[model samples]
Target: MLAHIGGRGFPPDEAAERAWATALWERTGGRPSGAPVARQIDAIRASGDRTAELRRITAPTLVVHGDRDLLVHPSGGRATAAAIPGARHVEIAGMGHHLAPGVLDRLVDLTTALARTHGARPATTPTPTPAPAPPTEEPA
Candidate 1:
């Protein structure tokens, strides 16, 4: 089912498959469900104009889209990035809805680099621990 939906990036490595399967199972109790057809139709109809909302996002945004994604077309990603102010768009070649095993590190690197470039600082100091409270003296 994942393969049919995800298209080109299906049949991920065994470890990834197991991990994702476990996560999905835990999240949904293995009884996967999607929005109702009516709701989906309504959402599609209402999604026509979101430029104003997109423009209001002030935080640093990274829009990473896979060229081969079948669930959501690549143009949607492009449009999202274009609408958001200063949103960096990255279109990975040959990637689909599901990322290839090798692409994980690249995605992480891209995210880290973007955060660094946008002046987002990583936590340098460890959280200070509080000292233990002194024991109360027992009255005789």
Candidate 2:
């Protein structure tokens, strides 16, 4: 689960807002009316308790956050990671509000490694093993 943001997850500019808004409005079973959208936003803000909801989740989760995310705000990500029990949080610096534009391969390597491993532990020194002594029996 690669929860990436701060790059391509949001619209690149104001021009795409209409389409984005329309899709979101339609998905919520409401027509794309201005007042309805405003109401939806307000209702979302007034929602109730969710600890039971969060705890009901059964699958593994990944929480990725950008240190300088200006859109969704870093607090939301932090709270989200905290709310989900046992969720892993990863923070990257200088990754703005779009996650798909720059350094894709590097991002892939990072996210993949994150999802797969808990990161490299400091290497432990190998203990030296003593070699066994050979035949002194030939001298007898």
Candidate with best TM-score = 1
Question: Which candidate has the highest lDDT of all?
Answer: 1
lDDT of 1 by residue, 80-138 (tens): 99999999999987677877676788799999999999898987998889999999999
Instruction: Give the runs in model 1 whose Cα sits over 4 Å from its true position.
Output: 7-11, 19-48, 126-140
Candidates' lDDT values, in order? 0.83, 0.63
In candidate 1, residue 40 scores what lDDT? 86
Supply every candidate's count of residue pairs whose N, Cα or C atoms clash at under 3 angstroms.
0, 7
**Per-residue lDDT tens digits of candidate 2, residues 55-98?**
66655666777666765687767777778878766666655556
Worst 10 residues of 2 by lDDT: 1-10
Candidate 1's TM-score reads 0.68
Residue 26 CA displacement from its true place in model 1, Å: 8.1
Structural similarity to truth (TM-score) of each candidate: 0.68, 0.45
